[model samples]
Target: FTRQGQSCTAASRIYVHASLIDAFVAALREAISKLKIGDPLDEATDIGTVISQRQKAKIESYIDLGARTAGAKVDRCGELPGAAHLKDGLFLQPTIITGVPEDSPLMREEIFGPVVCVQPWDDEDDVIARANDSDFGLAATVWTNDLRSALRTVQRLDAGYVQVNQNLTIQPNLSYGGFRKSGLGKEASLEAMLEHFTKKKTVVIDMR
Candidate 1:
């Protein structure tokens, strides 16, 4: 759902093992390269215009920063696809950045665009720590075939919503919310309904 990565559930940061990092990144680049960037009305368009010019500029800056940062490599998804009417509109090519540091701006802040940062991790402890280092814990996704590893990692994540061996998805029956600075309160479930309608009562006794 890279509506140019504007969605809150977008997988912005990916931590991959050294053995499979190259393959994963290659696959992502290949997939991104084929995206059809053009007018929203076009049925062939996989990517449409950004919300505004300011957002486009911000996303571009992050891409540039990712390229300049040490230990970070930025790969743009080549030229924009055929978009006859989108020439003057705010359209940015899909980008994939690898070797990103945990503290890099691209990794630290929400890009809210079609830019994803890839980092390699050798240790599970380190990866979990890096994942939780974020101030925003909206959601997290753990992709692993091993059940033990998936459960362990999911338990350690500070995110309010978590998915194991799957991409971020919101079902109607699930409560949607975030931890830390992401947001407060809940929405879209029975829990949210109770939270909104139920009230607590306190009684004091003067027996003292």
Candidate 2:
């Protein structure tokens, strides 16, 4: 980490390790490639259009911004842009970007699209260090066949929630929140029971 990336890298956020990073990214890339980018009405399509036209435009703008940044690369299905003609139904292909700079806008901003950004680290400690550096402690998952690493990471990560050996979203029973900008507070049955309510009182008395 240099002066440029050092700040963002340590800005209280989560980051993945270099060793495990590539494999996880590879798995996601493979899955994204398999996604069918087409109209929902078309049974062959695996994914539908953006929730709103605004979101479609947002993705476009994000891509544009990414292109200008350092080593940014975006790849999407050739059919996605053509699908725009389906005005009644919007659709975009799965987009993947590599070589994105650590401090680039693409990495700093939340990309809630098929688009994914990849950055690498050295080891488990590095990954945990990067993750904890971020202000956002929303959620993180560690995927590995190794039970020891999974258990250790879950205990050490700064995020409110950590799912071991499972690369997925927050479950209903699990609490969810970020340590910083990622969230204001956590919400979950367990968390609620832990600190959702409280009571206190003071009684004054005189003694000689």
Question: Candidate 1: deviation at residue 11, Å?
Answer: 0.7
Over 1-208, each residue of candidate 1 has an lDDT whose tens digit, in order, gives 3687889889988899989999999998998888888877778788888899899899999999987887778888956755465569788888889886677888889889988888888999988999999989988998888999988888999998999877756779788888888887767799886895578789998996
Which pairs clash in model 2? 12-133, 12-134, 12-135, 13-133, 13-134, 13-135, 14-131, 18-121, 137-179
Residue 35 lDDT in model 2? 65
**Per-model lDDT:** 0.84, 0.60
lDDT of candidate 2 vs native?
0.60
What's the residue-level lDDT of 40 in candidate 1? Answer: 76
Error of 1 at 182 (Å): 1.1
lDDT of 2 at 111: 52
Over 4 Å off in model 2, which ranges? 1-27, 40-44, 81-88, 190-194, 197-208
Candidate 1: where is the Cα deviation over 4 Å? 196-198, 201-208
